[model samples]
Target chain A: MLSLEYLQECYGFNHSKWKINGEILDTEKGVKRLTNWTEEKRVRWHVQWRDQLAEKTGCLTNRMIQTIHGERIILSDAGWVTLHDEVTSLFSYKNRENEIGAFFGRYFSLGMQDVDTEINDPYANNKLKIYLQQSFLTKNSTEEMRFLEGIRRESRLRYNKAKEIKEKAGGKQEPIVAPIRSLDQGKVVYGQFYWTNLKGRPEKGYGSLRNVLTEWLQRYGQTSLFSLLNEIDKEFSLKGYHGKNLLAECLTPWEFLEYVMKTRDVHEKDELLVWKEKLTYQWEASRLLVKALGEWLDVAQEKVTV
Target chain B: MTYEQPSSLAFSIKESVWLREGEEIDELLSLALEPDISIREADDQVFIRGSLLLFGEYKPKEQDSNSNSYSDQISFRSVEEVTMSDDGIGMIRHSFPLDVTIPREKINRLEDLYVTVDAFDYELPGKGCIELEANVSVSGIKHERTEEPEDTYDEQQDEESDDYYTRPQEYNDFSSEREEMNERSFHFEAVREAAADDETKDEYESRVEEIKGESKEFQNYERNAAFEQHYEEEDQYEQEENNEEPVSYNTDPEIEPEYEGETEPEPEPEPAPEPELVRSEPTVNFSPQPSPVSAVEETHELEEEGEEEAGRDQTEKSSSSKDENALYLTKMLTKGDQEEFSKLRMCIVQDGESLETIAERYNIQVSNLIRMNRLNEERVAEGQILYIPVKQTPTSKS
Candidate 1:
């Protein structure tokens, strides 16, 4: 909803100089895009991070653009406005997983020291246990109910194991600025993946590689995931803190917890059946992810001896 | 594949190809899944014969053109290197052979041959032409025949040649060899003799100090003279070469000539005439360059320059060279700023013109052209109203 005059005055554009296509401005200088994010600090961090990322790797990111006023974010009637170059070329980690993996691997090696945010504990929420205690006092004889007992037992054991791993990590658990869904192909343009919406998580330690792996599972599945890991391993040497932290995250039973939370408020008997299928499906998917991660760990362990 | 010996001949082949006219390349997906290679030996030289199957997507210049996609099996009977460039809109394919000499020991033991296209690079240097370079390697395996049992062969050879080790009666004849050894001084006697004839330590040290002092004085004199000469020359040069505009110190050769028009040329009052849509053979300028390290600090400073006076000051300093232009686009591309060195100009697609050529002209990507136009495919016809992303100021045609 930015006025044309505002763009002309602030950006030094001649009146009716640039063509507007939705959120993108096709100017003689280059393609400029309007971004939804407005926070100054986060926007600045993104600028710095992407700048450094491009400096380190040949790959470029769609970072925020500065206005003619020497400002990255300008206050306008439609909230704080930020612009970025909209790269629409199709470049994904599909066949080029190694390159994508190498990108993240180099990112991990960059070390996210300046990223300021609270340490997110992946195991901080105990809502699953609370939900199970309240909703499952009696066996409802549903298909989902039959698996709940086993799931609860397994989740408890896995949760404790993760806790133990974190305890071992202790003071060494350094938070990293991790992309929420970096593996998503929709964000990639011209071989540059959008490394935006970064969050700090100490649970996965530096690079937040565990978070990336989980995101990879959700988007790309396990196929060629090892190749991606191998590429990352080549760049960042995902041993010690990165390796152990990722393993710990892999052990977390988020699938079960997510299922419990999804059906937590539902009291109707009929609605439970639909949720049952999803729970079982998520449980199996989570297991496959865990198994794949375990195998990668085993191979990595063998490599240590070699 | 069987070989008589365990040796192989390796061939390194380099080839370059141009994209067909009217078609612009978007991205090279990959080389073909398998390579078809054959090897022949004649006149003590090995010949590698094969075709490289290149898989990629190409955008035709004309909408509704049949050749929307590009996949080619480029055959070659080539020497070590082959380079070809032609002017037209038709697909041009050529091949060369690489002659590999087999070592004498393994010449006759050739068995199996393998070829792989290991490296590739492409450049869209204006025009709808994509210059592709592929580095292919062909190697032949040497087959080794099974040998007779080592012990038996050794025993048989020993029996055949009874003079394996002769116990000579002249074993104690060290006198002949001893004389030569005794004459040669293999120790540090020469060092002792040189040291004996050297100057005294005090004299040497004082001489060293004198030399050092003299050198220092000479260096100081040279430095002062050079500085004075440089300033005097600069004063004279400034007086002689003074113009209305300030001098730019930017010396990047790749960028210097590009912006020569920027500062020198007057803006044309009239819009440029639309270019004819004639199929011009893409000039095969195959120079692959690595992106140089940008002056990021200087760029950040430039970004903070919003005022007109500051802008003039910057223009005086660098005049917005291609590096700066690249940095400018890079900044925009990297989500940095809406700064402008050039403005977008509307361009009409000439005949045999592809998005690649248009992008090259603008120094942008073909994909960007597709995105900016929101075209379903990277196809454009003559007189198509496509926006050139960044029209270079004082525009120079390549």
Candidate 2:
């Protein structure tokens, strides 16, 4: 519901560029423009603005950018709010069939080959349009781990704050849990310049929530601390995932995980005997999750409308 | 029994087809065309699948005007030939797939097809795909199967020879005035409105017919004419003679052919085309851009000639009157005829020969004539020399 007028007047987002990415320049809605070569000179001002929000909140967060009122504007200062856990399992090297197979899900689409591959081949000698920079592959790449740790603490704190506010108001209002909406129609191939966590940020920021979660597991070591509560069964079921008994009312990610790990007893004859593997990190998994939590908020509409 | 005379017909049609146009501003820098062609014949329909593989090294344009910009374009194109089945319905729908329903009735074959890039450029300044507009010319050729009487061979040949001259859009700038001039009198319409004056319709048409026949003969005679003509001649520049009596095109051209006796065995020079900038090599020692005369004033001059012709000579068929007929037809040359005439000429600019006199003789722009030969002076003394681009004729070519 935030208006560009509010963005300009209040936040001083006066820059003509980033505030206009995916903007419907023509009066007729038929033409959609992507300023593919804009090089982030204009949009960086807005991203820097988001950095200020992070500075004030003391929590690093990314904006969910989209088009409304025929202009591309940030909907929320935080794109990732509600955390998901299974996405980390998907990114695990143990789960994948091949060394590079883990990168093939929603995140890995089209990308330029390595610089050497491009130099040898006559046709494609240009730098990649979308891919993680080689610098991320270096041995001491702990920046990703730091990013995940920051988000885990931030989400746990936010969930606790939302619960406190709800309890204080006698449970009359909904809690603050931000879910994700797919960027570029859930496409990662040739992702345009606009699909970034912030201006000049790598496209890894805009990968599918599952893909980004997997990336965290590879770089930050396996963790399930960020999974939101889901429907998990007692003593685990044959489905391996006990999502049936996962979500508990008004609890944060790691809080719900700790509750499940403690309640589910180890029975020798249980068909889902391997449920302990997911809880290996005990109460310290730190992955992100996203779902249609907005559906839960509109409880009346969901019950009557199909 | 009717004898079938071979009819040469070329069909020209325009169709808008999608072309593969892209621009990689940061990568490979050149433009080349590669095509994948598929020809399929299915129940009364021919489907042609065509994909163009456009690849090239793209050198970024020089940002500064003072720098060299020699690598502007690379001449790269791919042409493919595929057999298409003609449907019974003569209407063909040609798409990028080249999927078309070609009428099988009259078309003997798709003799030749060529595509020209009519217009192409970048629509956006910064980063965007290139916009290319190409004109695809598909010539569906058919032959006339009608039989001719043996005695009428000469008459039929005259009529059949006209296909050599009917071309599209190559006219002098002033030729646009023809449509307006045609409204003044229908008789002028029959003249080469392209070259038409206030002459009688019969006289003009007859003259155009003569030019067509002569041009066809010249093309046949000088197939390799462009390669062999190497003659050394001094520069012959003449000053403008706008002050003198306007030269009439009604002079007996056969009288001018007396000079042909001197260069009888030399190779005939073909017409110099305009926009010679596109060609790699210059054809003429000095290339003068040809210009047709303005109609309003030229028409008035022609009306005077027409009256003089009517008073002095009759349109008789005697051998004596053939020169008059030649003179009448020489003025109404078709597009191809005009091209045949733009050959190199070394005119010893005599005392009376002025700029207009030589320009009218060559049928080229007086300004361009001056620029091409680099005419240095305003006045022409005896033997001051000029390169008059006289129209090549049977007599002139040797």
Candidate 3:
């Protein structure tokens, strides 16, 4: 029942300690701290994001997945996943290869855990995914793809430049730029949406994206990945009632795919399977693109082999 | 002796008339003839015409001796005829009657008797007057006339009557008595004036002499007392100045005690005891001879002792300086001798002596000690050592 304006005025929209797959993602810098904010402002921002998600979808629920190896798995209402296996998993899901597969395979095999069965209908996940895919295509899919592509291009450039710098310096220093994935696409899409809606004029879009990212990093990115992932789990449960419908509606297949990519990385062979699951209308649009891209890549590999 | 025939009474009657046309003369006569008759006319005419009867030697039956005896037989009448004018005054007049009678004894009692008649007379413009006739009677009884002595007695009585009319002799006596009283009063006043003059002179002389003597005596007494007081004051002033100099000098020893005897005796006795220290330390071997330099040093030392005593007194009197002196001595001893100073320090530390008490005993300033030791004066610790200055004695200058 809390309006977005009321939430924004009272709780604000800034995130605190964002995490992906149990690892903390670095925002840029100069982010305002949640502790520095009044409790009303903190709660308001939380409620705002919660409401936004709820407006798109039904009530969002959260589940904590604990692996047998003492790993933590946090699943969002849209089945976006985070794992706390290592600090590197917060930025890049490829680092948590074993833990990610264990969580996904367990969920697929067990169908629903006892904790998840207690809070939600056992059959709600399949319906929820379908709802998320429809909403993404209708409302957020194109924007999500655009945002993910921009972020991917930017991250690739940054990684290449960092790698080049390290090579030229002849140092063993790791690259400073984090790897990109489609899971970051959700945040990028929302960030760009916020930029356009909150900060952008018609004359200037994405004018303050860097500043926004910088502030997010400094304020909410200081905590460890495990704590951040736990906090995101709590945020999903707390925001379930408010932003469930909104998120259910706005989380399209592209957004879900982006969420999954940023949250979980796949090998090249499994990429098509991930695309097939996310894109609901295989005959309509994304299946063609996927097939064409797969054929072009096969041809290129064959050329390289020859 | 033939009594002269007493003359018969000759009586006459007079009538005076004024006819106013038929006035009867007989009526006038008839009226005149009445007994005890008297006729009067309007024109101032009077007539007496009454019978006089002779009664030779006959006394009347009812006659009393106290009454007068006289012949009563006489008659006179007179009538005057006058022409009355219109104013009723008579212009022309005629007398008509007269009567007379004589008794056997001549009546000689009448001397200057006169009868007067008054009548109304209009023409005369005033009341009328009477005409009088004089008569003299003589008796033939006296052959020789003699003066009686009784008459002379009467004449003398009459002359003595003038004396009654004048003032009596007692008036002169009263006047003289008044004059004498006045004289006595004058004499009394003069005597009182003289007595007052004598009293004033005597009082003025005695007062002048008394004042003069008292003034001289007062001047002498005042001069003697003033002289005595002047000498006493001078002596007292000099003694006070002398006393004050020593007290003030003792108060501030920067002004040295010039009186050697007063200051030296106490310190000399005390300093004599310190010689045992010199004797006991024979190895130190300080010279025993009291050289001139030693004397000078001793005097300086004595002066220092005096100054220190003064300072001690000041410190004792003043609460502020007690600590200062202790600190000063502690500093001095510490600066000069470290081991001995440390022993003193140990004493202070062990004895738990207060800074002020230590200051007084050591003859040093407490502040200086605190500064040297780098200790807070307010919080001096136990086991802190303080140095004490040795006080030296004074010697005789001679």
Candidate 4:
């Protein structure tokens, strides 16, 4: 957090006399009578500072200013300050009533622009300092874009997590209770109960592994790890299926590891190690995918989580 | 019944005939009056008797050659009749005997008892003459009678006497002496009699003496209770009076205070003993006296008791008589004092103290202080002071 005292210290200035348009000007009177200062007087002061700073630097594009905190350097063109692209995008200059004067004063006080820009000199060096300040330091547009990008990336990760889970389960067989005999083929074959039942088979079943496993998981997942793994295997047919057949394919990496622990008579330590390795590999792969996608999408990488 | 004079008149005059020129003659007549016009019904009719004078004018026919010779042919006839009828209206009919013979010369001559006709020669075809007859007849009528009112003074006097006798005579003496003596004694006797029987007077007196001692002891025990109750009651009365007074006073601020706290109980006991003393001593003095004197003495005792009770009541009321006045004066004084004090405090604070410090010292909110002084909170400077109200601990949150 920026403390009020620090901001005050950084911006504080002492009243002083200076020469403007070949005339001595009192800083106190200038500040006090700022409302009464004519446009001519302001322009005259601007030109005086422009010539004095330009004579010392011998370059108009880049100039240094003295501020309360330290010396700041900026780019300018002629005497007009230039803003950075990010900063310019954050705050529009079109509708600003006092854009030039406010930008000059702000940059001048902060010492982030050349003194030639503060004097309103039309020089390339002064323009360079204005451009840099407007594009980079003056407005915090990049931070805002990063914040929005983080939100978008987080939503994408959630979407992908759900999508991955969906794809892993896409080719699994629903379940079959009895063999289906096709009238044209004269043979019995394992098929989903819904298809057999629709074909008017006599032994159509009312319950399936998916329904039972989902019910069991919903009831016992929080209390027992063994039941949770059992339900997962039964629902996915992970223990019974392997290879690339569409009706009964092997479980995806995460699901297969879960299946091995449920079906094999393994010690608890072995199952944990298996689960830990699979999870670590899945996490690493997910992180790399997220990082590459995030960059391509111009989004933040903080979105992807397990 | 009251009678008012008739303020309206109704009358009509009808001629007996349309007279022809030659048949005109002098007529002697007696009028026939309708029946039922008698003295008993006299109020129904009005009578005006007088002679009617007839004046005649003659004009000769234009077709006649003697029109210039009849210049002096005009004549006058006068007749008199006594008129009596209801509301000045009368109807008369004359009957002539058919067998009576009369000479033509006599008919042509103007007679006092013959009918006469007057005619006019005119261009119109209708009859231009009407006949008049004179006959002798006696006529009379009965009229409505006016009644005389009966006397009721004797009956009213008798009723007044009876009404006077219905009321009790003793109230006079009761009221007369009631004002002369003390009312406290009278009420005390009444209350004492109502409380204790006559045969038990001696017993009651002794019992009362015992109770007096007991009461004094009980009073010591109940002193705090009675005092608390009295104080609480007084406080409640004061608050209610405070509310009633201002509302009433605001409407009519100059109303007297004695009317406000008239029922308060301060001087009641002083007159209490007076009735007791009067009740005990008066009957003793009247025991050997005559009946009238004893009656007088009894009445005197009653009056004395009444006066004593009244005096005690008045004395009791006298103390609180000033209470309302005092309260009113105090209320006025306090209001004025508060306003003046607030003004002075505002001046003092405005001279140099900060509003926040003043608000803190007075235990009021800074916002309230600013509002009271009508100052802007953000722009207020040091030593730009404001009014600090004397804060009261709130009794309840609204």
lDDT of 4: 0.22
Q: B48-132, model 3: which lDDT tens digit per residue?
A: 2332111111111111112111011010011112112222222322231122111212222222111222111111111121111
Span of 10 residues, lowest total lDDT, candidate 1 chain A: A198-207
Q: After superposition, how far is residue B249 of candidate 4 from its true place, in Å?
A: 29
Give the best candidate by lDDT.
1
Worst 10 residues of 4 chain B by lDDT: B243-252
Fraction of the real A/B interface contacts present in each candidate?
A: 0.00, 0.00, 0.00, 0.00
* Candidate 4 per-residue lDDT over residues A1-306, each given as its tens digit: 222233223334345333332122234323110111123333333334333433432223112222355523111222222111010012222222232223222212222122212231112133322222221212343332332222222223233333333344354433222212221111112221111111111121112222222232233332232333323333232322211111111111223223333433544666655654654453333333322222321211122221
Total clashing pairs for each candidate:
26, 40, 80, 72
lDDT of 3 by residue, A1-306 (tens): 222232223333343334332233223321221111123322233233333333332222111223344323222333323221111111333233233223212211221112211221212245323333331222333433333333232223222332232233342211111111123322222122110011111111111222222222333442222232223323322122211211111111233334444434544546645553443232122222222222332333354469
Residue A152 alpha-carbon offset, candidate 2, angstroms: 29
Task: Give the local distance difference test score of model 2.
Answer: 0.25
lDDT of 3: 0.22
The local distance difference test score of each candidate is 0.40, 0.25, 0.22, 0.22
Model 1, range A236-265, lDDT digits (tens) per residue?
Answer: 775556665666566656666776777768
Cα displacement (Å) at residue B83, model 3? 99
